[model samples]
Target: MESFPTELGVLTCLMLLAASLWIPYIVGVNTAPAGSLPADAPDGFIRIPNPALHRPWVQRAWRAHLNLLEQGIPFAILVLLVDRVDGFTALTYWTAIAFFWLRVAHAIGYITGFARLPLRPLIFLGGWLCCLIMGYAVFAARMV
Candidate 1:
């Protein structure tokens, strides 16, 4: 079989990660104290107006998941756009791979409240830079 682009593979993993990141958030919520949610709450019910009410870890999980989605959506678009225009390059491959790992680390750091000040943000910034690199590469491909 022909080899597919590595960036697409990384994108697949990122997509799966984003889809499943909610697991920890939901688990944290369900295991929280009573009165967190209505007993007869419907499926897909999420009504937490005051996130402060939940455990700190739960809040982190929610935020981590949200951050993943925030980054994942844009990353997916850029990767697909680059691939669509046949803009595959060594830089794209490496950045896509780095972005995936950076996101994983970011999620762990966020959920565990590890290094909230500097390290965590730096990790996030790394992933953001990866996206920027891919975006720039795609734009540059148009000039070639």
Candidate 2:
């Protein structure tokens, strides 16, 4: 197996983590009792009257996955640009790792209903900081 850079490996792991968030959502939908579905649900489709109101955790899982996508796009672009333009530095590597861990925390907190009040936002900010740091590193490298 070819050894990949630590930064790249972290990025790959983040991607997988983002994908993993969907598991809870899919399972939640499939496992819900048929009787709980809306009476007007299509013959072959499972439909709830109001998923966000009735299935908050499922909504949380789905939103957590979406949040990852929203943040991951920019993070991925920055990491790739940094790697291609100036190579990964210690800052980039550590930032990537921090971002991954922060996201993990966010996802767990969100899905498990532990993301109360400031906690979730704090975790999100931490990940955003990591992205900012990495983005700055790329800009700084270009200035050198």
Predicted model with the maximum TM-score: 2
Cα-based lDDT for every prediction: 0.87, 0.82
Over 1-144, each residue of candidate 2 has an lDDT whose tens digit, in order, gives 965778888999989887777788878877877577667666655454345633678778888888899888789888998887765788888899989898888989988889888999999888889888988988888888
lDDT of 1 by residue, 9-120 (tens): 9999999999999898878876767666656756655545344557788889989999999988999999999988889999998999899999999999999998488998
Q: Once superposed on the true structure, which residue ranges of model 2 sit more than 4 Å away at CA?
A: 1-3, 47-50
RMSD of each: 3.3, 2.4
Clashes found in each candidate (C-alpha, N, C closer than 3 A):
0, 0
Clashing pairs in 2: none
* TM-scores of all candidate predictions against the true structure: 0.87, 0.89
